[model samples]
Target: MKISMTVNGKPVSAEVEARTLLVTFIRENLRLTGTHVGCDTSQCGACTIHLNGRAVKSCNILAMQAEGADIVTIEGLAKADGTLHPMQEAFREHHGLQCGFCTPGMVMSAVDLVKNHPNPSEETIRAELDGNLCRCTGYHNIVKAVKAASAKM
Candidate 1:
């Protein structure tokens, strides 16, 4: 099957198998390695990306399902000159990541949350981020990063 979509602000098309997961297509076919595949199951949001401007776990969807859609990975969030996105900056400043395995998805999801709730409380942030699992950071600094990014926005 051939899938075509806008990815990271660029139009992309590729031939993929029917069973190809969106994450595999992004990381393997598109060579966008920033979207990590931490878990094959959808429990981990390590492969999360914005599907039509909303966050969705790429591991849970087929590449064919993403055809004709707009997808934004962590690589697309930075400025053209390579400056970090506000959420990325906040994560760096607040030490939100330890092993860095979950940083890409965490930052992407945080950006989405802040967009939906510009001034989310700590509790709300925690609730919204419940689906994203991070084994290294314990989520303390992650929540703080979201708050800091919210303030900047």
Candidate 2:
């Protein structure tokens, strides 16, 4: 199948198998490696990306499902001048990551979370992050980062 989409502000098209995952297309065809493929079964939110402005796990969907969609990977969160997004900067300032393997997904999810709940409470942040798992950093700083970024975003 042939899939076309706007990824990270660029229009992209490629021939992909029906079974090709969106994460695979982003990381392989487009060479955007920030969207990690951890737990391909979708148990981990490591492959999360913005599909049409909403964060979704890329590993959970076929590439064709994103045809003509607007997608944003972790690499797209930064400005063209190399300035980090507010959420990303908050994560770094708060030390929200340890292994950094799950940072991209966490940031993506946090961005969506703040979008829906501009003034989310601690409980809301925790509840919203139920899908994402981190083996390190018990989520203290992650929550803090989300809260801090909310003010700026």
Q: What TM-score fits each model? A: 0.97, 0.98
lDDT tens string, model 2, 30-110? 999999988888878999999999999999999999999999999999999999999999999999999999999999999
Please give me the total number of clashing residue pairs in predicted model 2.
Answer: 0
- Pairs in clash, predicted candidate 1: none
CA lDDT, every prediction?
A: 0.93, 0.94
lDDT of prediction 2: 0.94
Task: Residues 21-108, candidate 1: write the lDDT tens digits.
Answer: 9999999998999998988799889988999999999999999999999999999999999999989999999999999999899999
Clashing pairs in 2: none
Q: Judged by lDDT against the true structure, how good is candidate 1?
A: 0.93
- Cα deviation at 43, candidate 1, in Å, is 0.7
Q: Note each model's CA RMSD in angstroms.
A: 0.8, 0.8
Model 1 segments beyond 4 Å from truth? none
Q: Model 2 compared with the native: what TM-score? A: 0.98
Tell me the spans in candidate 2 whose CA falls farther than 4 Å from its real position.
none
Where does candidate 2 have its weakest 10-residue lDDT segment?
Answer: 129-138
